[model samples]
Target: MDRIKEKMNQLRLEAEEASTKVEELQAKVKNLELENLTKEQEITSLSHKNSLLEAEVEKLEETVKTLKESAAEGQAHGTQNETLNRRLQLLEEEAEQADKTLRETNEKLRQTDIKAGHFERKVSALEAERDQWETKYEDMAKKYAAVQKELEEFQMEIGNI
Candidate 1:
């Protein structure tokens, strides 16, 4: 009977040890679940922040595209302005030649007055021609100035753009 009691006591001790091990395992499992829940919440917050950053990046890209388009338009305008300036230069050269021709014609008329019998008539016609040339020259000069002013304003606008 003593030996049987000793055997029963050993069985009881083994059962107690098994129960304690089970409790430790259950506590460890509960702690792991808590840690997993905390990690999941952090991941959700990080995902939301990542989406917001992506939206901002998209907006910045659109702005860059608009700026590039504006630069291209400005370059086109600059080329057109250069062409206009070249035309104005040609017009200026023509005006200068017209003035020189008028001067030469007036000198010829003065010499004709000294030698020709119909000097008065010749002088009057030559003066009229000179007056017309002067009017046309002045008009061309005014137009050139206006065009130059316009070109300057266009250049300023391109810079601003």
Candidate 2:
């Protein structure tokens, strides 16, 4: 009976040791499950952040493309403005030349008018001299007629003597 009791006590100790080991294994399994759940949640959060970053990168690419197009348009506009400025300068120079030609024509017209007035005065003086010469010729013809009549009377008196 003493030996049976000792054996029974030893079996009880063995059973308690087995129970503690089972409990420890159960706790370790629960810790492992919790760690897996935390890793899953972190993976999901990181995936969402990566997607957001991809969208931001796409937006930046589009903005860069738009800026490049605008720069090209600005360069074209600058070229057109330069061409227009050159054409306008040429037109201004042509206008200046035309103005100078008009001034020269007006000066020539003024000189022509002065010459016309001088010619008119000379014509008037010539007409007055022509009238004086015609009157002198008429007086000389009357004196010659009187002297011829006196010579005819003297010839008739000499024939009677």
Candidate 3:
């Protein structure tokens, strides 16, 4: 009986440890989800920026095309000037800036992907741990019930004596 009680106590302590692990896992899950949400938002924001950059690139390409046509017309008319040269220089600078922005956005997207992968792995590990704890708890509960039943039977025998 004393051994059964000791087992019960041991089971209780193990249960407490399991409970603590569950709470910790829950907290980690919540935090990870929040971080995932933040990363998603960042990805969304970067996508918007990418769209805007694409639009700007289209606009710049159209401008460059128009400038080329204008330059051809100006050469035919003997009307060339420094102003057209300056406009071409500005357009080149804008194109370079757009390319740099695209590269940076791609880098940020890659980093978000890495973080999401890490979070997924952690969640999977926690789920496995939780399952293990559930199995152990059930096993302990069954053992405890069987011990209680045996103790009751012994008490009844004593009473009849």
Candidate 4:
């Protein structure tokens, strides 16, 4: 009976440890989810900025084309044309940089998504383990109760003798 009680205590301790681990894992999962959300928001913002930059580049291209046509019609607009060309080149460079940044952001998001999935799986496994531990603890508790009842009955019989 003492051995059974000791085993029950051990099992209870194990169950509590498992429960603590599960809680820690759940907290980690929540933190990862929040980080995932933040990355997604950043990706969205980058995409919007890229689109705006592309639109601006298109307008600049149109203006450059018009200026070139005027210059061909004998307009002394060489200086203005050169300035516009330089501005257009700078805009194109800016657009390329933005595109590169967007691509990098997308890759980061993909990696983060993968990490989140891994954590989710880990959390699920931990939760399952915790459930098993809880079941074991309940079984131990029942056995301990039965043992105590038997002890009580034995004591009563001895007293009657």
Candidate 5:
């Protein structure tokens, strides 16, 4: 019947649309995953830099202690002690700046992880929608086939009469 054919066409179109939407969502999820990976790599690099800065700060602190001991024994000049103090101050400042940068990088990585989780949820929902559409399409196809068979059987009966 014309009505049955029309219904089949509509269901087919809806199924195709659902499939396309699922594909688009999957692509978006892949892109978000890649972005998360990039952010993780950046965090790793920043952590390494922070560790190196910490080691430098420790070395400078040791040097300052040795200089203080020399000054107590009156072996080191006053000017040299002042210069070492200034250098230690600068190194401490650099270490603080590095620590701040590391914290900011960690925050960014956390945000990226959140975004990736959101996209993953969306993909899962879309996939479920697509599966429902496929099931509906299959049910419609079977009904159409049954209707066509009924029409043929009625035609054969009329011809015999």
Candidate 6:
């Protein structure tokens, strides 16, 4: 009957809405997960750079120690002392540059952590939304099944008539 057809149409519409909601939630989750992954990679890269900077700092300190020792022994000498002083100044500059790079890398890592936290929260929220969509879709599916059964019975009755 016309009434059964209208009921079927409404049920289908509700089901479609639920389906769309689920799809949207899934997309949000996917995008957030990708962003989180990128943040993790950046963090890893920053950590590696930190290690390299630490190593450079250690090497510079060793060179400075050796230069000071040579300067003490060469107090009687002048020409090589000038060369050692110049090399020491260059090493000091390299140390300062390395320290600056290390600080910048740390700052970047901190910012990345904050962004990653935000992404994690968003992903969690989207997962909750996905669960909500799943519940709604389940409810709509049940309603649709009931409507289908009722429509089928009605059709049978009309046929019999």
**Candidate maximizing TM-score:** 2
| TM-score of model number 2 | 0.56
Q: Cα deviation of 63 in candidate 2 (Å)?
A: 1.3
Question: Scored by Cα lDDT, where does model 3 land?
Answer: 0.93
Query: What residue pairs clash in candidate 1, if any at all?
Result: none
Candidate 4 lDDT over 1-161, as tens digits, reads 99999999999999899999889999999999999999999999999999999999999999999988877864557767888999999999999999999999999999999999999999999999999999999998999999999989999999999
lDDT tens digits, residue span 109-137, model 6: 99999999999999999999999999999
Error of 3 at 144 (Å): 99
Write one digit per residue (lDDT tens) for candidate 5, span 23-123.
Answer: 98889888888988998999999999999999999999999999889777675556678889999999999999999999999999999999999989999
Worst 10 residues of 5 by lDDT: 71-80
What is the model-wide C-alpha lDDT for candidate 5?
A: 0.89
Error of 2 at 56 (Å): 1.7
Worst 10 residues of 1 by lDDT: 112-121
Model 1 CA lDDT for position 37: 89
TM-score, per-candidate, Cα-based: 0.55, 0.56, 0.47, 0.46, 0.40, 0.50
The reply for model 5, stretches above 4 Å from the true place, is 75-161
- Tell me, what's the RMSD of every candidate? 34.1, 6.7, 68.5, 67.0, 67.0, 69.8
TM-score of 6: 0.50
Model 5: which residue pairs collide? none
- Candidate 1 lands at a TM-score of 0.55
Cα displacement (Å) at residue 63, model 6: 37
Tell me, by lDDT, which candidate is best: 6
State the lDDT of candidate 3 residue by residue for 45-130, as single tens digits.
99999999999999999999999999899886664456667778999999999999999999999999999999999999999999
Model 3 error, position 69 (Å): 1.3
User: How would you order the candidates by lDDT, starting with the best?
Assistant: 6, 3, 4, 1, 5, 2
Per-residue lDDT of candidate 2, residues 1-161 (tens digit): 87998898888888888888889988999999999899899999999999999999999999999999999999999999999999999999999999999989989988988988898888888877777776776676676676666667677777767
